[model samples]
Target: MKQAVVGYKVQNLLNFLVENPQLKDEVIGISEPLAATQTEFVMRRRRSLQDEDAITVYLLGMEGTVAPLPLVSQVLQWQAENIKAFVHSHFPGDADLCGIIGRASQCLPPLRKALNATQVDKDEVLSLFIDHIDALESAKVPYPSYYSELLEMVLEDGFTSEVLHSKLFQDAAISIKEWGSPRQQQTFVAICSICPTATARMLLRYCSYDDLSPYVFDYFDQRSVGSMIEPHTYLTIRRRLEKSLSRISSEINVVFITDSSNGAVAANASGAADATFFSVRPFNKPVTLDTLFVLDAATISSFHQLRGGGVSYPLLCAEARECNSRRAASNEKRKTLPQGAVV
Candidate 1:
């Protein structure tokens, strides 16, 4: 009768029989239950026999979140065997088994020390475990979802409390400083709900005195401006505005003058000259010879006729005369004042 290998098992068992020619005549009968429990049963059988030959036990897709080495040690103790080789299966996607095994080894220091293990013992155990995992991965074993969740929890909680807070503040300060400018700093501070402070000083570096004033004003707009004023406040705004205006006007010049033609007239015998004639149109009415300039009664009569309609000429002439008088007074006062003195 042909030897039977259990559970539609690998045909390699036939090759095994041929290699050990002495075993050819021995009937090979395999059981599904025995194959299923092979690792546990073999460990027990080996201990009972006190076998000299090393036995390999493969734990395929074992469950539970405890580190593998300690768990494997417990299982070996339950079978009352000093395990020659203990291996755990891996899935196809398990790429970092070396790192995982290194971490697992840390949890098994007692087991390693109890085993009186040398470097060679450690290496042999790791090699055996890795080879089993490699074979399982090649066979496309699936990893349990609980293992993934357990790994995520470990990673998430790994940071020390001190390191976590340090990183938090470091990232926050850097983010605030990179946002740019004093106005932006204030805006960001307001948004972040942070009080102004030296640690947050970068928020204020690009801010000018004037830049803060309006916000200060609006901040205390309900309160008096005097209460909001500081030594830096007024100077900063004044300097900023002066600098801004200087930059704007650097390429252009502006001059202002009043109509001199209507203001100057020959004095009469009574020391009262005839009403000075000034063109009455818009304030910016173009200065042209045809825009009838009236002096004395004759000019006034001609201006009335030229107007024909629209706005009273006598009223316009009176307003223009008042304007001219005020302008002359202002110029006389300016002449009296010292140059470069503030008005």
Candidate 2:
């Protein structure tokens, strides 16, 4: 029979994906059915299946590849769960209902609109959902998959897509609080993968640890002496930052002030103003001794200007005044540009 043949082919394909480790890594997408044998495919952990296009192509190559009835049931259950979560998070007070009811309730508004009803009370929908939920739960197959599709949905376009991420996955929110939060570092990188500009410019600026400060000072140090900053502090600051700012364009400027082996110092910027940080990648750009001003007076001046000299997030401010009084002695005129100001 056609049904038997299709079922056999589906089983074979699943076997092929589960058996070949390299193919699983590079091409095969679904591994949820293999969860009993492979812990790596577990939902709460694995991010996604790779090679989306290749998997689609491979599936198309099979002549009349038919998904088994069980697989069809699993897809319906997944859709049911998604609907349940969506309604519970948004509609309020209906969170306790069973999943099948939830899906029917979501469909009510459109159904009513089609039926020419002006206003449809959701309480009736919830009641209908509750009545059918028991039967639905008993009769259907459930998707043994992880939450990868929903997670991926929320992350794309910085979760700002007016149609997709915002409308459907609105209840699922992603937050990376600080550097030390467990899994925050991973979420941070994930955000960068989808929305690098926002991650570098806005998200990092808000974080406890970010590359903004060092990038500013390094850009400034081209005009000053390296001897001003202490060896240990400079290395620590340098270690914390990984020249990733060159990839993002931000108007915000960070002024750093660090304690030195000696007293504070200042930058002696040169005429021509040399360069700006954003707009162009500073690839092969000259490294500056301005790092020497880690805790120097000039950096402090900018911080003070940002927070009105009171304590606040120093690196988060857009603009601050530099104390160039120390540079007053330099007769060699230098045009100091506001970092990212030109771009």
For residues 1-343, write the lDDT of model 2, one tens digit per residue. Answer: 3222222333343334333424544432332322222222111111222322211100000000111122222223333434434443434343432333334545456433422435646655444443444444443233111122222222322223321111100001111122113432211111111111221222223222332212211221211213222334333223323343333322212212222213122211211111111100001111123332231122211111222222111111111101112123221222353432210
Evaluate residue 255 in candidate 2 and report its C-alpha lDDT on the 0 to 100 scale. Answer: 19
Leading candidate by TM-score: 2
Which lDDT tens digits does candidate 1 get at residues 1-343? Answer: 0111120121233224323435533423432222233223223322332322321111001101001122222222222111111122232134454345444445456433523454435456555444543443344233333322323222222212211111111112232333223443211111100111111121122121112212211111101111111323223322333343453332211100012223212211122221222211212222333222232211111122212312222333333333334445544654686864322
What lDDT does the true structure give each of the candidates?
Answer: 0.25, 0.24
Q: Candidate 2 — which residues are off by over 4 angstroms?
A: 1-18, 21-74, 90-125, 133-343
The estimated TM-scores of all candidates read: 0.14, 0.17
